[model samples]
Target: MIPAHEKSETHSKIDPDLNSKGVDEEGETTDHNLTYYQQMQEASLEQLAEHRALLQIFNLHQAGRIEEKWKENESLVVWLGMQIAILKRDFTEYSNCPAHEYNGENRETDEFDEEKELNELHKKVLELTKLRLLELGMFDDFPSKFELVETSRPSKNTINKRFNKLLRKIPSELFPSIRELKFKNYIQSILDGIKKITIGHKIYYNQVTADLEEKGKLKFDYLFQTIEFLLRDHFISENDLKTLFQEDHILRIFSIYFFHSSQQGFSSMVKQLTPSFITDQCFWKFGFSFSQVLDEKDKVRMNFELLIAHLFFNGNRLRGFQEWDSFEKSFGRKKYLDHLKNPDRLKLSTSLQVEGKEEVPPLSLIGTDQEFSGDVNNLVKLFLATLNGPKKTRALSGLVCELLDFINSNISPGILDRSFKKLGSSKNLRLQFDLILIPTRINYSMAVAMEFHDIAERNGLSLAPKVMESIFISYQDRVISLNKELIKVYSQFKNRYGSLSSWLKQNPEYSKINEKSLNQWLKAMSIIIEECATEAKELDRRIQAAHGTAH
Candidate 1:
């Protein structure tokens, strides 16, 4: 244990990184003090999208990276030192020999082997460090030999100098008792510092963040659809698409599907497919082609509609409420409509902020997905206003990003409690359900709006009460099946956890690795989080299944 005088210094270093810009002197964590992963968890949805986009650029999701510049990094040097110390401690304890037992060498004897092991501990330390890092789902991404920088590699002397400098930064009041500091407590501080450095290393770029905020409004489902519309329009013919793309079919899926929403893979896939052929191409399709946008066929003067379409995902993601009416009537949803007054009073909105894209692909790619910055109050207000203004009650759900985010939150909550109950007490009851609840509600909301201009029949009209009940029955059955699968998952996770604990038992210092990294790796390997469709999607399946070919 450290003397009372040194306790403060030890606590100060062990608890917080004094040099880290965002932390307060008192070691209180601030927003700036958070690790990158923690910041990601708390970031706004728009911010999250940009961050994920940046990750795609860096290929960070594959594994963590280490840069050449980190060789001289104080935190990394200290971590290497700390790791070497740990190796020595474990080796000494397990060797069952005193430090004095080193009479230099015999070739084959166990005593000789012990001496050799002690001599080789440094190499073992590096191997142990890499193994530990790999277990945390990371690998060294340091530059190859030809890319080496001129800086000297970290050595014991450098580590000592850096560590001493760190020690000197402690308040003078705590300096007197430095000799009393405990080894374990000191190493723990190094661990904290190292973990923070790694977390920062995995994700750090000020400019990308700035770019995300600046261009966020342009990156939405409309972007993917816009890309698709253009992609389909790009090729000379179907044969052209097939010849250029290995997975050409992935592009034909006009909605958010596969990696279409992830700018990571999507950008890389289309990086070569630039549209230099026509700034006027929007005139060819969707009324925004370059030809249509030009003031005259040959003149370069731009049209407002062309610019608006370019900036906002081709003008369909957001539109006026009145347009919904015109679209339904002129574009043919006349059969489902009733007359309503002041349809033009409000503008419709959806397609979350270009920045606000969710990581999970929406089940349906449409304008109805919620806006990132919207509130429940606004959605509720819209619901109330429609009751009075539009007696016909069509073209609603426009202003609010309705149902996509939170329909499940209050939508007939607890109505399913009795339905969710199993009939038999037996755990093995097999159940089958057609559609999850959220998707069905999303479908219902879209049906009311008729954004796609389909008549009530094929749209979502078939999802009346009885049909909804059938879908619910399918969902309940799926829930039971999911529970059974979860039980098996639990058993597998238990075994994995036991194996991890047993491995760590062989080296107690492994406990000091970052808890977040451990948990992330554990959860990823175990698949603890469930994956299912968004509300828009489940509704479609439910609808299609219900009306596959009625008599």
Candidate 2:
């Protein structure tokens, strides 16, 4: 800690500088105080010899001279004396005393002629101090080294054991077939996502984060599909792929996959790959020479079409909505259109409707598997509207109309209101059911929309009711199972009470209690539970009838 006197002196120094600059002593005018704080910090750090020693040690270690200086002596006796002299001189110079003082005797002049003597003394002291500083090596140009303990490197066996431990954390299931087939070569390539290179068949992952790869296997399913697409497009050949796998040259494959993944369109892949190999050269059998680069618009259409095809027909995973079993059901039922109320909608004669003859198909099957036999002009108009229109309801209405046409169902506002009433008229239950209805409605809506487009007669002969039953089983089963559990718990509570009325009568001492309201609520819940059980049983019956399965 600095002394109070020294702090006063520091304040006085700051006042002079502030007064000279016409700034306030409080420093309110300045927006930044960082400079003042930084100077104080620097001074504090400099005054501490230990801090300087630590800095010097760090420098020496970085320069690879730590081992050489690890045994050097660091005695500070000589430095201590020099520091004391410097402090004494500074204190004397700054003291509030006259330069000269009369000796304790009668004299010719009141002031003694000791000014020159004091100057001579000061000069001699300064010279002596300089000599001492040099002798003590106080301002020597060389950096001081600190004595640090030497550490030994781990033995090869120890290193091997640690490396094996890290490798064991990764599961074998996540390993590629190439990794499984070629152990030695696979070890050289990047198994984990740690960014490093192999030099002369030695793996060198970043030592700073070597254990990062042990966290878990990252999902690269998207990258895998992209690889498959490239192979199909002949952008990469089968033989080359096999060679990469055999040699464990995964980096090359990664290079191409990431490049294509980040780019906009499939034509970009062709443009990018063309430069890597000759089109008309020896490896021309993959149809590289004659392939034309698609324009941006065409590429978008083709890729979008491919995306829809993969998602609906080829059973590809949808990005975020992969969790719901209903999503899987929707994808699986793409083959069974036996339930369509309007089967003629599947045989899209034209994309438009003739005024007197027929009504237009509600859902425009833009990326259907077969060529769109619809009117191209109307299709273009709808496409443009979908792309540029501000209202999503226009698109949504089309989907709803299509679904209604398929399910042979109609929505009446009265019916919906009545159905909601059955959930419960109480505010709390209404709110709960409202929340549950959001997801339920979404599931049902999506199921109808997807199942309507099942033009492929892939699944065997099944009736309309059976198709609806299949689409609804996952959702209904979940609701039934949940409600059944709730009923079981509530039944246990009722059994414990002997009856709700008995429990309510017993608790009448509580003034806030409304026994009548409680009885009504309990009775309503029992009815609700009974209805749920009945609905569940009906769903089970439908499921059984559809699949021809026993309970």
Best by lDDT: 2
Worst 10 residues of 2 by lDDT: 210-219
Cα-lDDT of candidate 1: 0.27
Q: What is the lDDT of residue 450 in candidate 2?
A: 27
What is candidate 2's lDDT per residue for 351-404, written digit by digit as tens? 332343222233333232122222122222332232223343122222222221
Per-residue accuracy of model 1 over 352-419 as CA lDDT, tens digit each: 21333322323331222232112223333333343234433312322112231222112222112112
Candidate 1 minimal-lDDT segment of 10 residues: 426-435
Q: Highest TM-score, which number? A: 1
Total residue pair clashes for candidate 2: 1
Runs off by more than 4 Å, candidate 1: 1-72, 96-115, 121-551
